[model samples]
Target chain A: MYLAKIKVTYKPSVLDPQGEVIKSALHRLDYETVEQVIQGKYFEVRLSADSLAAANGLVESMTEALLINQNTETYNYTVEEVEA
Target chain B: MYLAKIKVTYKPSVLDPQGEVIKSALHRLDYETVEQVIQGKYFEVRLSADSLAAANGLVESMTEALLINQNTETYNYTVEEVEA
Candidate 1:
């Protein structure tokens, strides 16, 4: 089986109020050193594929088509094989 | 600088309607081979820390206090040193 961990985040130019709120919450918790908290989406995708290359191709296509908003968000992923 | 990528997902016992919807959409797009799509939250955290150990400590505490709801969600993270 193939497991894909996909992350989609707002582009740098986009405003992320959720992220800002989380950052503020962290600040309130006395985490003064940390900054720029951007909140996005995480997709845990599992599929049966012949190979890593095949899984990557299908996942990349999925991201472009539905998993991400191309105009406002940027995405990246990692593909791994796990024992089913 | 320290960079932390954190993922928070609903526990297996919880319902994930968002993930189910996405999976159905993918199925409509003829992605029959793929299955079990679970969607969650992704956090990109940046901070200035003296060491990776310190960053991990603060970040972990942040996760417990604010990031993930321990009752229904499971969380994991990766911390790295990044160039500012």
Candidate 2:
């Protein structure tokens, strides 16, 4: 099986309200050491593909079509093979 | 500066509705090869700490106190130095 490690996050230009909230929460907890907290979605996708190349293509398409929003968010991912 | 890569996900025992919805969407997109998807929270935490050990300690406490909910989710993180 292939596991696609997907991460989708807001564009740098976009304001991240959730991140701001978490950052404030951290400060409230007396963690003044925390400088910034940028939050995003993480996904571990398991799929069946013939080869590494095939898995990469599949994951890329999945990421483009459903996992990420093109206008507001950008994403990055890595694919690795694992024993099923 | 330090960059902490944090991931928090639902425990295995919990049902992931968002993941299921995405899986179904993938199937609709003819990605029948997709087996499963586990979704989680990802954070890119930028902070200042004295050293790697200090960064790790700081991130751990932050994760425990603010970033993750102990009862329903589990988390893991990696800390690395980055240019400010």
Candidate 2 per-residue C-alpha lDDT over A1-84 given as tens digits, one digit per residue, 9 for 90 to 100 = 999999889999999999999988888888787788899999999999999999999999989999989999999899999999
Residue B6 lDDT, candidate 2, scale 0-100: 93
Model 2, B31-62: lDDT tens per residue?
A: 99999999899998998998999999999988
> Candidate 1: DockQ?
0.86
Report the lDDT tens digits of candidate 1 across residue range A41-62.
9998998888999999999998
Q: Give the per-residue Cα lDDT of candidate 2 at B15.
A: 90
Query: CA lDDT of B63 in candidate 1?
Result: 90
Model 2 sits at a Cα RMSD from the real structure of 0.9
Docking class of 1: high
Off by over 4 Å in 1: none
Poorly placed runs, candidate 2 (over 4 Å) = none
Q: What are the lDDT figures for the candidates, one per model?
A: 0.93, 0.92
Could you give candidate 1's per-residue lDDT for residues B1-84 as a string of tens digits?
999999999999999999999999999998888778999999989999889998999889889899898999999999999998
